[model samples]
Target chain A: MSEEIIIAGFGGQGVLSMGKILAYSGIMQDQEVSWMPSYGPEMRGGTANVTVILSDERISSPYLKVYDTAIILNQQSMDKFENTVKPDGILLYDPNGITHHPTRKDIKIYQIEGAKLAAEMDNKKIFNMIVLGAFLKIKPIVKLENVIKGLKKSLSERYHHLIPLNKEAIDTGMKHLKKFNIEKHIIHN
Target chain B: MAELKLMKGNEALAEAAIRAGVDAYFGYPITPQSEVIEYLMAERPEKRTGMVVLQAESEVAAINMVYGAASTGKKVMTSSSSPGISLKQEGISYMAGAELPAVIVNVVRGGPGLGTIQPSQADYFQSVKGGGHGDYKLYVLAPASVQEMSDFVADAFDIAFKYRTPVLILSDGLIGQMMEKVVLRDQVERITDEDLIKTHGSWATTGKTNRNRNIVTSLDLQSEKMEARVHRLQKKYKQMELEDLRYEKIDCDDAEYLIVAYGSSARISQKAVEIARKKGIKVGLLRPLTLFPFPKKQLFELADQVKGILSVELNSGQMVEDVQLSVEHKVPVEHFGRTGGIIHTPEEVLDALEQKIITHGHFRNHKTRESSIL
Candidate 1:
């Protein structure tokens, strides 16, 4: 199975690192994966994005025009990637800064209150891990154990002490995710 | 067995250089390729394998430093982007003329003149056709994947030392920035001064002890001597062409059309080939791993099999000229490209293949028929 995912948010929101963790998790699971980030000025403080592909076989292109799933954080990313998700795909977003809620009927839309939960947890940096947890809850592409191992590999040794707290944040995000169901249209007589 | 690690192409190149027993790295930081030096500095190759990693003041100084180190028969390397590489052309030419071995990595970004800090194959002509003003050729290796980016450092050094000439790793921002799995080699010891004296004692500038002083210079004022030097370079180039014509052909057995590309463009074209094949189009991809010693013979044979050849690149058609030269009018050769760092999608390439190559075949055949009649 192959999964093409786009993770996007503000530069400091850990969007690129989240994708890296996911890619590392895929590797730990013995899957072929690629992580491509949009580098340059946009990555300094503006909107940032990364395309991560996990496949059982070789990945052909690191760049993609569309994605099977889009995990968006900020309003800018939400506006840009809401429609780019494939039909019958998944769109997971943090409800903190998104102004316009996704209204697509052909795809599944879910919201994780990552910012609020991270604020409660007293560490805003774990916001991405929360969103990642929500994503895994819905998709389950890689196991949680593999994600923990990936986290250890991605984070430096000094940050190893925070893995438990990050793990707690993910669990909270998974518990707090709310699905937004598209209303079915009624046929006129 | 060595462990697999997820790394960017630039990072992999740096790690591989250290593991491959590179004696020194002198490079200036440039976008899309700064990671090469950054990794080297962080790893402290000085402590790891007694390899020296220094960040030069500029690209010019970095390449000149490479020349100095390579003159001593040390395995030296430097990396830069397109604009930065342009600054090193003179030094590269000097090294080529002096017959000094070195590895230069150009993690190419878009350009003619500081175009953009994005992935581009625009440097194809500049790289393969010799950017510097001299009758010289560099062994250019085009790596399509992160694994190749790591592997080709050793290969480039091998060829560089074997022929006592400079070799270039022509990569792009796409590979440099993108992360993928790579199997890194185990650490090898850097060549000691004793080893250098033993291997290249005759020509290397190693203290000039017990032998005639070996002066290294590109300046031969005498026309006849300079011409002989040029002939010697030409002979070495011809030998390289025969020995290092490397390419990979995918799904070309019954292909009606073929797409030729290298580096990152090849990776994208591979996808385009798959997309076209899924739609019942007999399309194939030919990726040149070596750009300078291009796989001309293989392309000539494929020209007879395919109805048309399309050269796809991120530039406004640089390598297409080489493709056309190789085909030699045996088939129609067309170019489809995106300039200024804009990457084309697989669907766009497939559309170009169907429109510019397949559907226009009748017109090309008609033109050929008219030309034959004339």
Candidate 2:
């Protein structure tokens, strides 16, 4: 199985790191993975995106045309990648600053109020993890234990204290997301 | 068990050099490849293994530093992007003439001048055809994956020493910036011997311990002596062509059409091949690992079986000429590419194959290797 995902948002929205954590989790689970970020001028003040691919087989073409899942954060990303999602694919987004919502009828759309939830939890950095938690709840490609291991691997030793907080944020995100019940899922993750 | 880390290609190249017991690294920072020096500074390989990592004032200084260090038989290296690499061309020629062993890395970006910082394969001709002013062929390795970016460090050094010639790791911004899971090799012990008499004793000027003093010079006043030196270099390149030519063939057994590409273009073409095969087009991909000792004979042999070949590149069209030369117009060859920093998609590559090779082949003359666009 292979999953090609694109995570897009403004410069400081944890767009790249979310893909990094996902790549690490895939590695921890013995899956082949690649994470390619948009390193052009768009990364400065404009919208930034990273393409993450996790496959049981060796992955090719890190620069993808479309995505199996698009984890969009801001309005710019929602406007950019809303229609680029594969038909019957998943489009997970945070409806914090998004004025225009995704209206694709074929793909599944899920919302995680990451900014609101982060404000509620009193930590703005956990916004990415909350959105990640919502995606994982719908499609549990990686386990929570391995995500903790992935967090330990990605973050330095000083940030180890905050892993539990991120874990709590992820649990809150999974609980906050109303359970997706589409029954016949075409794509597994 | 293997030691693995998820690292960007530039960081992986730096880490692999440190783990390979590289003696010193002297490089100026450049876009799309600054991580090579940045990672070495942050990791402090000096404390770990006494390796010296210095930031040179200029690209010229960095390459000349490599020349000086390599004369003493030290495993030294430098890295930069397209423009910076152009500045080091004179020094690279000197190293080639002196028959030194230094691994130089060119993480290419789009360039006719100080072009975009985005990834590109435009340097294919510049590198393989000898960017420096000389009749020398630099040993070139084009890696498609970040794992190969980590692995090719040791491989380049080994080949450099084995041939007593400089090797070039022909990577682009894509392979340099992309992050992926890389399995690193164990740390190799650094060379402690100052003289290095056992390995580089014949030519290295290590304090001139014995015999006649070792002389390191590319300049020979006598015309015959210079001719002999050139012949020696040419012989070595020929030997490399016979012994170490590296390439990969995918799905070519029953292929009706062939796609030839290298480096990042090869990775994109692999996906295109998969998609085309699913659409019932029997297409295959031939990826050249060593761009200098190109897959001429391999491609020529494959030409007898396939109807047409499409050379895919990130540039406008450079490697296509080599593809034509390799096959000698046995089958129809076409060039399809995207220039500047724009990368081609898989579907676009497949479409180009159908249009340029299949549909257009019947209307055009097969003898013309020079593309019409040029």
Candidate 3:
């Protein structure tokens, strides 16, 4: 199966690195993967996004107009990418800073208090890892072992000591997500 | 040998150059390609292999430094994006005229002027058709994948030294910035000074101890003498055309239509071919790996079998002219592209194939075809 995903947020929210770790996990599993970032001047403080494709076969274009899943970290990313998810696809978001919730009936929507949980854990850097954990909890396209290995491969040696904390954040995120039923929301609307 | 590692295209090229025993790297920083020099500097090839890495004041200075080092028979290289590459044209022409072996990488961006820093194949004419101010050809290699970006560095140097001409790795920002897994080769040793003297001793200006004085210049005042030199260069180019033509044909055995592209466009068109096939349309892709030697013969032969050809690029219409020239009106050739940093999607390419080449039967109207070719 091929999974195309987009993760978007502010510049320092680890959106790009989360995608990189996902791609590396795909590689560890001997799958074909590609990671492309929206680079350049916009990466300073503006919204930054990365497209990650994991496939059993060769991947074609690194850029995509639509994605099977979108992991949005903030309201701006949620506003931009909510509609880009394909029908029956997944839209996972951290609802901490989102003003408007997703209202699509054809796809699955899930929310995680990633930023709030990371703050409670006293480390804001694990926000992306928590969100990533929620994505895997819903999809499970890649094994958790592979993700740990990917983290080892992606992070430099000096950052190795933080892997356990990151792993704990991912587990917490996996348990903390609340599924949002779009059908119920649509009927209420 | 290094194990498989995920790397960006620019970093892969830099690592491959070090493993290929590049004697020196002289370049200026440019977006989408700065990692090439940055990686080299961080790795400190000077400490590891005694290789020289210098950041020049400008692209012109960097290319001229390459020219000087290549003249001494050392394996040297430089890289830049489109605008920076434009500044190195004069030096490139001088290198080509002097028949010096060097490698230049162009991580192309949107063009015409200082356009957007997005990936583009707009430099097709500049690279394959000879960008410099003279009648010289560069051995242009277009790499579609990060693996090719790494492997082609060594291959380009081999071809460059064999032909005694500059070779260009024509890539773009997409390949430069994206990350993929690459298997790096074992490190090779740089050629010793004695080996250089033994191989290029005749023409290289390495003290000229026993033989007559060696001179390297593109300037020959006499018209007839210059004409003779041009004829010799033409002969070399002819030889290259005969020996170095490289291309890849995908799913063409039963294809009724063909899409021609290179570099990043080729990757996208390959996907288009798959999508078209799934839709019951027989489409194929012809990707030119070596743009200079340009798989013209193969394209001509394919033209005899396919009903039509579509030249897809990321430019207004550059390589389309070459595609048209190759087919020689045997079948209708049309161009479809998105310029100014916009890359065409696979669905768009498939739509163009159906709209322009197949379903509409646009080739059936001879008058329309003639006008379109013009």
Evaluated on chain A only, model 1 obtains a TM-score of: 0.94
Candidate 1 error regions (>4 Å): A184-189, B197-201, B368-374
Score every model by TM-score.
0.96, 0.95, 0.96
Per-residue lDDT of model 1, residues B1-374, tens digit only:
69699999999999999999999999999998999988999999888899999998899999999999888888999999999999999999999999999999999888889889989988988899888999898999999999999999999998998788999999999999999999998887888777776765567787766778888889999999999999999999999989877899989999999999898888888888888888899998999999989988999999999999999999888888999889887888899988787888777888898898899976986787688679
Q: For residues A36-66, what per-residue lDDT tens digits would candidate 1 score against the true structure?
A: 9999988888999999999999888888777
Chain B TM-scores across candidates: 0.97, 0.96, 0.96
| Cα lDDT, model 3, residue A80 | 92
Determine which window of 10 residues in candidate 1 chain B has minimal summed lDDT.
B200-209
Candidate 1 local distance difference test against the native: 0.90
Give lDDT tens digits, candidate 2, residues B233-303.
99999999999889999999999999999988898999999999998999999999999999999999999
lDDT of each: 0.90, 0.90, 0.90
lDDT of 2 at B42: 97
TM-score of 3: 0.96
lDDT of 3 by residue, B166-189 (tens): 999999998899998888988989
In model 3, the runs with Cα more than 4 Å from the true position are: A186-189, B199-201, B363-365, B368-374
